[model samples]
Target: MIDFITGRGLLLLSLRRMYELWVNHSSQIIKQFSILIGLPLEMSNNSDSSLEVFSPAKFPKAMNELSALLEAIAATSIYFKAEIVVSYIKSHSLRIEWIEANPALAKIVTSGLLKTFSLETLFEANRNNKNFLRDVENHISKQLLAG
Candidate 1:
């Protein structure tokens, strides 16, 4: 049982590490591109056209494509992690008892980490549900305060 829990914890840690790498790399790339493309254009002209070019409205398709690419990358990592966990369970002949004992891990594994951490979900929430970030911030603030 300890081995089973340890293996799952390690899998979660690996997933987190992979996710951090993806976020860091994607953020750096986005920052570089925004600096190169968005900054110069904004500086040159404070016009609607300049803003429009960089706006989400102007390049919805491109934004979607980029989002899909990022999702694919994240999903791949999650799938890899899931595979590792499954392989460990199989090799050790671990039973379902560990999952039953750890409800949090069970939920994550069953529903999938990718779905829970989805960027598309974030974007959708931001777009369709205004104040999503504010809600998230408030929730975090409450949690921190409680802690």
Candidate 2:
């Protein structure tokens, strides 16, 4: 029984290690793949300057890291999406505050995403669903990807 327990612990450790390696490799691949696809795609909209994609011109490393991090986020499960989004919001609340100061821009971003996802029509259907966080993340992911 002790030997069995030890084997099971080792297996769990190995699985965790594999997962870590996979995430690291995947992040690296995304970094490279995005570059190959001619990254830093320019996005513009008249309505919202705050929602504008982060400028690679100012923070190239941040741009790369955010891109890879967002890709990993996209691949995450719905249950964790809300947790991640909430954590992100908590961490970046200052940015959100600044963006919200320009209400028009926030409106444009929310409206544009709602239109793109057609959530404007069906928001009531899934507004309370746990997966809504996942939807929000996907929207943010798109905006980041546009950079």
User: lDDT of candidate 2?
Assistant: 0.42
Each candidate structure's TM-score, on Cα atoms with residue i matched to residue i, is 0.21, 0.23
Tens digit of per-residue lDDT, candidate 1, span 28-136: 7756654533222132254333222223433344335434433433433232333233322223222466545544434444444323232233333244333443443
Model 1 / residue 110 / CA error / Å: 42
Q: CA lDDT of 34 in candidate 2?
A: 49
For model 1, where is the 10-residue window of minimal lDDT?
Answer: 85-94
Residue-wise C-alpha lDDT for candidate 2, range 1-147, written one tens digit per residue:
112345777878777877888877986875675454434333356344334433335334434444454454454333333333333332322245534454443333334232122222122223344354355445545544453
Weakest 10 consecutive residues of candidate 2 by summed lDDT? 114-123
RMSD to truth, every model: 19.7, 16.8
Cα misplacement distance, residue 75 of candidate 2 (Å):
40
